[model samples]
Target: WQLFTKPLPQPQSKSQNRQGGEQIVLLGLAAMAGALILAIYASGATALYNYSYKAGLMLLSLITLALLYWSLERLVRSPWGRILKAIREDEQVAKALGKNVFWYKLQALMLGGAIAGIAGAFYAWNLTTVYPSNFEPIITFNSWTIVVLGGAGNNAGTILGAIIFWAYNSITRFVLPTEIIKDASLGAFRIMSIGLILMVLMIWRPQGILGKKEELTLGQ
Candidate 1:
């Protein structure tokens, strides 16, 4: 008789993921730089630089959003997506069914990192600069808040939530009473309001406005 030992799988460390994310951001920045250089060579440097300012990145942003929304919709409806959902609901059950949960998780993390890289490129374009401070913990917290507000399982809800979040930011800047809430405290007040709203919603509608209760991972 022969005895065989199967090695236990090692879980991915957060530091590894953070390093991977940094690499993806660097790649995205490189690609954007390359495109800019090409554009400057083809068109005059002055012309290309002016175009970036006058052409308005809004059109590109909208087109990107549309394509992303369509792609995500298709992805969530696919078999692979179904497997991901299964894993999310219960990883042990997915593993029991012979599904490679680790592979699925790695794929998901890579895909998410790619998306973040693209977004980071857009952020640089919008601001015309990038710095270490730009990628802060607050950004991650805001992303989570958007996901919770929109409903985690539904992509459309996520988009809608982002729109609402930005709209609130735009409105409150002008509408908020500066007499009571000073300019310095206005931002904090808005965030607090959002938190209060989320608390109320969580107590009454934990699945979110658009998320199906059956698909809510909170129940799991």
Candidate 2:
């Protein structure tokens, strides 16, 4: 597998190359899922088994957030991280130079999935249950809004985006007159406000408040 990532002494057939790539992707996904499950179970057991559910979840969220931030920061600064950025910019060029483009992409997918899985677990824990409605398409759009508002490539920006998004909702819910706007109308107003904010951001600062102009891949 390691040898496949380096320049091959001789070119392999297309079938063989395809098979290898598929195997790598499958293996990477399995490993990522397994690790995520194991970590969640271990943390849940350690926290929930010994303490109240709310307390356990709180502890777990703090620990998870810290570790996630630290790990991602380190990973993004590593040599392999540079390769990831290069691949993102031009996968064909990376592949042409004997870099395992499939492997890199698979790694990125697995990493992203694992992080999202952890977040989902925490959210479910908070809600005390998971429902089909929780996985709605609008959730994906909201995530995109957070990412775009914070900054696409900046981790700190992402965190800031989430904070700002939620803070706005929290403030509005507290300040808005429930007598004038019923629950449904209040929800609709929040969504409308978010849409308006996003539109203004897109027009005035498409790169995001914290995102650098160079980090943007939109016009490029």
- For 1-220, candidate 2 gives per-residue lDDT tens digits of 7643654333343323222221222222222233333344445556747545455665566677667767777877897776766655555556787787767656776777667776777666655678998778766666777767876566766766766776686667777788878887787888898999999999999878788777555113
Model 1: CA > 4 A from native: 1-54, 217-220
**Residue 174 of candidate 2: its Cα lDDT?**
72
TM-score, model 2 to reference: 0.73
Residue runs of model 2 more than 4 Å from their true location after superposition: 1-52, 218-220
10 residues in a row with least lDDT, candidate 2: 18-27
What's the alpha carbon RMSD for model 2? 8.9
Worst 10 residues of 1 by lDDT: 17-26
Tens digit of lDDT per residue, candidate 1, span 69-182?
677668778987777777666555567888776666656667666766666666676557779997787666566566666664777666656656655765687776778789
Q: Give me the overall lDDT of model 2.
A: 0.62
Global CA lDDT computed for model 1: 0.59
